[model samples]
Target: MSLPPSYLPAGGPDPDGAAAGKRTYGPDFLTALFQNPLDPGYSDAAARRATEGRRTGWRRGLAGGSSALTLVVIGFLLVVAYRQTVAEEPARTKARDSLIAQVQNRREGTERLRAQADRLGDEVAALRERALGGAAIAELKDLEAATGMAPVRGSGARIRLVDGPTSVDAVTGERRTDGLVKDTDLQLAANALWEAGAEAIMINGQRLTATSRIRQAGEAILVDIRPVASPYELTAIGPDELAEDFRAGYAGPYFETLQGRYGISFEAAEVKDVTLEAATEFKLRSAAPSIAPAPSGSASSSGPGSPAPGSSTEGGR
Candidate 1:
């Protein structure tokens, strides 16, 4: 039986009865895998190279030389970087040591100055007491004590706070700063002590006055521009109920939350014979007579002419 035109054998005439031609299979996955695995472009390139003969020796040498030059340049750059790092290490270390030494020297100088100032302050106080009357001296001493200008010793409460562990929450995938103590936290703690009727307070030995500032500069906490590091210790002089009152205040529950939720360390206790130092700075508003009183005969003429004490006469100007 004769086969149909469309079902002709391999290397047969086309189905449309055109000239006889080689039968071809499209380059699908199975055809490429079993019949011709090499890519057609690579096969063509190989045949072309064979017809043209091998590359000239100089060209081959040029390709190999280019690769070798690239490797050499990369190796040189790596060596230079390593040597530069080694050479700069000592310089960096020396600069760090110099800065540390300067810091130590400045700190020692500051301490010496502070001691001298304290001695001068004591001398001034003694001279002032000798110049003023007994009543005036008593009033001045009371004022100084109340205004945190003079150190005092008494029963009081001590509060300590410290930073908690730094960690990311496993479930929430959030890093919490609640564990860190901030300037605001100390401010709140101080305010709470004041609210609890504390007569005098000191934070890390720095007296807390009305004009004193508790603030943050970068990661460090500053009290009156002096950096105070953690585990912050706060001392408050007050009555017997100082600790109880502080714990009842808002700062108590606030600290409790920090301890429970954020792992912050907070502690408070009452103790006797707590001593707080005087503040180094104080701001006072004073008034003095701006003009001398008139003579007895000219008293009536001075009524309108004499300005009140402490009143500025430069208002209009």
Candidate 2:
């Protein structure tokens, strides 16, 4: 109380006096503390509020960091789940498709057998017109008796056809069988063998008899029960050189032109006659039932008995 107030530094003001003057707070409080530590708690409420604010800031920071970590973990889990799901989807679809196909084929085969049984009389009548009398009828009876006696893989060459699209050249604009093996292709190859005097033919592992038709299923070309694929190799016992020379000149060149685009391999060989048993079932399509005697002067069967010198399905698969 003594003399007058003391002098403060050049940039400083009298701290005690400043506090005593009013309840100064906010930035001013921090300023006052640094200036004079001796000063009393002039802004006690403000001091308490600052302390609480600092604690709340730290707590909020921790909460935000924790939240971010949790989100990251959840995201990681979701990504893993998504990958696993994608990987398993195709396998499951393929398995399901395979099961469905098997079931359908078995059903179709069963139905075909039933139809044959129903039309037995008509089939025999058609056969009579063909060469069904005497020796032919006798052969039929023998064949029927021999059914399921044993599985005999007859002498024949394995003819195969693979997936070759229309024009391998995207620009050629040629007609192709959609990258799927065609019934026509198999038929043609087999026909060539027959023309070359082939006794029998097998496509893939399946035996091709009078009634077998090449069918496309999924990615396969079915010859009866056997499946065949591209750049088909057809074997005939009569002539390796003959078949090669024939196709090399006719279908062979055409095949090379086509394969030049798709890249398939074609080969033919001569072997001993393959011994394949008669097909367990035959599919008769014409109005003429194959087993029936010929309808009085209907002409020789254009059935298995006749081979098309030309004309067959194109192949891709």
**Best candidate according to lDDT:** 1
lDDT of 1 by residue, 72-111 (tens): 9999999999999999999999999999999999999999
RMSD, each candidate, Å?
Answer: 15.2, 18.8
The estimated TM-scores of all candidates read: 0.52, 0.39
For candidate 1, list the clashing residue pairs, or say none: none
lDDT, residue 11, candidate 1: 67
User: What lDDT does each candidate get?
Assistant: 0.78, 0.57
Worst 10 residues of 1 by lDDT: 299-308
Instruction: Quote model 1's TM-score.
Output: 0.52
lDDT of 2 by residue, 51-115 (tens): 76644577889988999999999999999999999999999999999999999999999999989
Question: lDDT of candidate 1?
Answer: 0.78
